[model samples]
Target: MSEQKNTYRSIFLWGDKKIRPLEEGVRALVKEQFGLTEADLDQKYLYSDDEVKLDIAPALSEKQLNELQTICGNENVKTDDYNRALHAHGYFFGELLKLRKESIETPPDVVVYPKDEQEIVQLLAFAEKEKLAITPVGGRSSVTRGVETPQGGISLDLSENLNRILEVNEINHTVTVEPGIMGPVLEKHLNKMGYTCGHFPQSFEYSTVGGWVAARGAGQASTGYGKIEDMVLAMHVVTPVGIIQTKDYPASAEAWDLNKTFIGSEGCLGIITQVTLKIRPYRPKNTASASFIFKDFETATLMMRKAMQSEIGVPHLFRISDPVETETAFRINGFVNSMSDKFLKTLGYKNNSRCLMFVSIEGDKNYTLLVKKRMKKLAKKHHGFYIGGSPTKKWLKQRYESAYMRDPLMDAGIMTDTVETAVPWDKLIPLWKAVRTYLESREKSYVMVHISHVYENGANLYFTFLSPMKKGDEVEDYRVYHQGLIDTIHENGGSLSHHHGIGRALAPWMENEMGSTAMGLMQAVKDHLDPKGILNPGNTLGLRSKI
Candidate 1:
């Protein structure tokens, strides 16, 4: 096999281990936004150590190590400093700060690669007996610190061996797969069978099917394909108590929906061993793309709400960027002074005020064409100018690439992050203004907002903010900003998170968001399933005091 270029040691960096240089246009945009000169940009904001050095040692004894080796093979069980360091924390900004400085406080005692469900069952049993915390790691793509091994027992590395497409049910239009299967692997396998899962999150290249189910994640095309929860038909989870397998039924009045109990559990309830999801036939020829320029963010949202409620059909990828984001998009994509720019200006679409919308419909040719036509009519009725499908195509081509921009920005003395929340149509405008206002209030900050995964009653507002990094106080500054953003979202009547699950980052706010009674109920479920509290100690639900 060819050597792997990217590994967990370089988790601080995005994609490959190599540091990607910022594009000239992006660098210029950053400088303009942050009021920085060429000399200011020359200074590196963050520095990552070349060598992995964590002083912490494994807590597991030789006997315990042998026991794990017995469950998995000897080669599958790892105790090296690098492997432990790799599983110490996730891709959370705070964790990245620590990784860059090689200042990890706690590292997992051992990393285990279970080959199959049977091995997972055995490992869970062993963990229960030994009272060891086990954090199920899929792709290590968690930005919420969801995969951190705070309790330092074991890091269950599923992506190693427990990754395979188990079955493809053509008649039922569903596919069953092992939980460790990454999005690209599963999608490729499904595409070969002329079907698609239709879930394409920005982290699609690195995230896993189990991670999606565990976090209740949504893809970029969620407006049409629905979120991961909607696609998951059945699940087989291995809790500390026992295995709970939900039946695969189209619709059922089944007792209490155990599937939901574990869907967003974040490995607190159990480890998702296997999953069966609904799949759609691949129909790229039937896909339709369209773009529109609205006078402002509010107008674009109004048109989106109308389109969603019209019952005509929602687009597979419906998105509207607020004025700031629209301006940023224009600048970064070199849309300024272009023919499209002059044409838009001629039609009263001015920069810094005009919002940009991208629409994509996927279905049968007739259905897609009909939806596109009706959506276009709605846009026109709302004074939206049709800007052709080129923008949408451009966005589709660079959707995943945008995530890589964060690392380069961080390297150039700039701090960048994203926070998303969902709100009803009535509260969308207020929430948008409130969060945007708070973010922009910060000094040297550039805030961009966008609406995606739209619904009839509401839509998701995703905010991307960039500011000058406080070199020595990166994590502390991040905490302040992150907490303020969460508080603002809560105060403005927005969901804590739309797609990203309540990992450790959001665990503190769970009670405030879900209420005390609801939290108690969830706690009860967690206690019953994980009496020993060995599965992901500090995770979505909250920090557990036990093992």
Candidate 2:
């Protein structure tokens, strides 16, 4: 493959391993957080199993392989075991454990990179005729194994030649681009043009625009810019039947919005080849942030709800870290802890018994100042103590690096994962307490939570958990632990997922999230669109027996 082709490397926990070994400083930091000694470190870090060899399925015949090669160039089609293995599992902890052990069960037969929309169309027809399944993937950053290859299929790696910024409608504040364009690259181009897509998922650096729309993602600043579903004005998807291009209009009175159906379809119905997204000029205004410490979780959440519901101004970035997460986050970052000692402790960080909320606002210089001022007033009303701006600024700088920590944590024999769900404000407290209580009772895991993407009526809760691997049964252990959380989410009336799409990990819960009738309608739609069941089977709709 050419150097440009290599530009499509995966990194969000699924790609190549290039992280430096735990340096002495990081070791010291971890020891401080987890209270481990040198011997303990050695014992924990030495956990490794013999690389369980992969049982790759048979490859395509020379003629069949040549047929695909002719469609999208020889270099774009790969049948090597290594490349196939890399595209298999997603970033899920269980998947990672399997990867670390080299125990992949379902590797794709062949991986193909289509150069353009026409090639994708041709490839889909070829797959249909050959009875081969197709899975569309970009950056392969799925944490739910959504991008995993089917039992036997070709993984259409759309990240290669299809990546480009096709057009920028400066007058209308929109940009049209091929689907495989990486998030950071697209954002950089928009920034150069004094505009931004403003969809900054944690996976921004490691994911693609197509993947964002596929997942219907929400960014850290979603309060101001809106979610991916809200940002997409139009999209073009290619399926076995034909191409679907949603209308580009500000408002539609149509009975059913087709774009909404395909926005979070998760590549089940079709392949998203091109997207026209709403963009905004770079906010060239003053920005300020402040941190608040609430005495309890209830008060913190209430304060968040009030801030979001108030008519003064909405903070571009808002987050409330629960007590356990607040402490854990500070403990892991030694520099931030040192700063707390010098400045924040006097302002109440010393207690370490409070939930933390970081609120940031950006707009007209004077308006931004007023927003921060109003935020401080609201916080005090809800029994919040100011902890200054250091923490919030620190959080902004390191927000994207949070995903990188997973690899090292796994290296240290710790199993870590995050799950998110949304619920209305009234039900937030119950869901929050239920999740923490359930996990605490089940596993010896550390759980932390934060609220983001706050709406007037509801908000999203993101929970992160970590625990030592249970010997050789890591996968089974994770399954049980994760199932408990999912149950809690559903019981408390939260959506099965807020931003993360329902990939294979949560496919079984589709019926629970959506009643049988609704789910049947979705299945009916899928069946009509992909009659052969050749598209991403066992994804959002779950695996089904042949009709």
Best by TM-score: 1
Checking candidate 2 for backbone clashes, the offending pairs are none
Location of the lowest summed lDDT over 10 successive residues in candidate 1: 1-10
lDDT tens digits, residue span 73-166, model 2:
9999987766787677668766777766656688888889898999989998998888888889888888787888755588888888788999
lDDT of 2: 0.79
TM-score against native, each model = 0.97, 0.91
lDDT score of model 1?
Answer: 0.87
Residue 250, candidate 2: how far off, in angstroms? 1.1
For model 1, residues 1-547, the per-residue Cα lDDT tens digits are 1213223336577654555567788889888878888877766555564566668778888999999989899999998878888888777887887776668788999999999888999999999998888999988888788988778898999888988998999999999999889888999889888999999989999889999999989999999999999999999999888899998898899667778888888989889999999999998888899999999888999999989998988899999999999988898778899997998888889988999999999989999999999999999999999989889998999888788787767767787888888899999999999998899889889998999898888999998999998878888998999899999999999998899887899898888878888888888888899898898996556746477
lDDT of 1 at 328: 84
